[model samples]
Target: MAGSIEIAGLGKTYREPVLDGLDLTIGGGVFALLGPNGAGKTTLVSILTTLIRPSTGSAHILGVDVVREPGAVRQLIAATGQNTTLDEYLTGRENLVMFGRLRGLGRRSRGRADELLAQFGLEQAGPRMVSTYSGGMRRRLDLAASLVTQPAVLFLDEPTTGLDPVARRSVWSDVRRLADDGTTVFLTTQTLDEAEALADRIAVLRAGRIVADGTVAELTATVGGQRLVLLDHDGTEVRSIDTDGTAASLDAALGAVPDAERALRATLRSPTLDDAFVALTQSATDHQEAVA
Candidate 1:
């Protein structure tokens, strides 16, 4: 079974505060953390993964206290950071085998290596040196290496940073499969599209705090309701209006415009996750600037 995460009053600091009284509860599913650069996403991940200590408060992963039982928490979780950690001199298959060996897989190491290679669609390139692999291939190998023991909880920080569309979708498929099999996936990514597509829930981090947390629909509704997009007869840009999800609101918006009769088409659309992210982060930034 996968694990749940509980954090309360978590705070971290160095020359400046990174996280401040952050509280969260994440269960067995894909939970994505979204934030801009320097929003303390990496700091939170490091603290939760047991790589760094929190300045105050407490955290637990899979019911194991992160501070009190770092080793036990480490045993239940796997992490793949933004940077590549694979050895360029080693083959993809060899890397997996090496990880399995390090994890004490012993006699079953090679079998486990083969399984991950096949699972990640790297079987054909298993024998190829990591130096010869492309960026996407190396990413797959890195992720495969992290899953050598099939951890109950997985932490991925920007897992698909440089991947192409097809490769990104490939990784997304793997993530969905892992979650379907009952693994709790904690992911941080800059791509709102990826979060919208993969995350069962999302939390927006800003200014060392979680500004918002919920399903995509819930978050999007916070910025505003749905939207109405209109196109002109010449297929040129017309206007987009924030809507209240009522047919009357849509009609009123279009009706209020002088060129309503000349409109070629009108579409009522729900605000996208990206829209919510922008609105929330911008609000956070504006609030900070005003206070400063």
Candidate 2:
């Protein structure tokens, strides 16, 4: 069966191809598209959200073709871009209620606004003008506005781009709660930490194509297995030895370390998403250069 968000042979071109023969399938959960700048992440979101049509290929949200039935697709999905879409002059609650009314919620708009304000932990700030809200608060309100209609799929394009660590984690919690509630969140971000923290599955886009796709552990394993690191008394890394994460491999690595007792301690470290991302994207770049 097709996933909640499906793309087949997806391509988009402007002067040059931004997305090339892309294909992806995301089931109901937090699915992240990770890539560097100009990797066609926003282009894909635009196509899927019906903001723009693709040059080729098909995209569907919950079985509704975005190209053929954009109106239907719009009803099933909502998107929050990098910039806030809330009205600064209006109260947080007012912004949500406005969105609700735009969605034709009628008298239920206020009720839904209250529900979202409370859900996003903005009950206290809901009555204040958006201009007075903190960056994090505004972001939460923007997200809440997107959920006023309870979309099946929520597209978040770099949801936490310019926030401090605390604020980013706050948004991360909100996203987790939404996914837990069965909302299929399609998140696009360049930050590896964000993807590692939020995504149930991640696809790495390089240039215009997906180079890797898998769970966090799976992608990390692609770069390499566990590593054994020797640390000095000051907690500085003395040496790093690569291992296959097996007992025999670790034993061999340790046996090869000269004067191992001199080291204060040793630790096993697994390959992180950052390692996988750098390795995968660099390999893609090398391959593209060779092809050219």
- Give the TM-score of each candidate: 0.86, 0.84
Measured by TM-score, the strongest candidate is 1
Q: Could you give me the TM-score of model 1 versus the true structure?
A: 0.86
lDDT per residue (tens digit) for residues 107-175 in model 2:
999999999988888999999999998877877788889988878899999999877898799889989
User: What lDDT score is found at residue 249 in candidate 1?
Assistant: 80
Model 2 off-target regions past 4 Å? 228-233, 237-268, 283-292
Every model: Cα RMSD to truth? 4.1, 4.5
Q: Residues 1-292, candidate 1, lDDT per residue (tens digit)?
A: 4339999999999989989999898977899999999899889999999999999999999789999999999899999987557988989989999999988899798999999899889999999999999999989999998889888899999899899999999999999999999999999998899999999999999889999999988898886767766677776546666668777887787775565444457776777777778777777666334322
- Global lDDT for candidate 2? 0.88
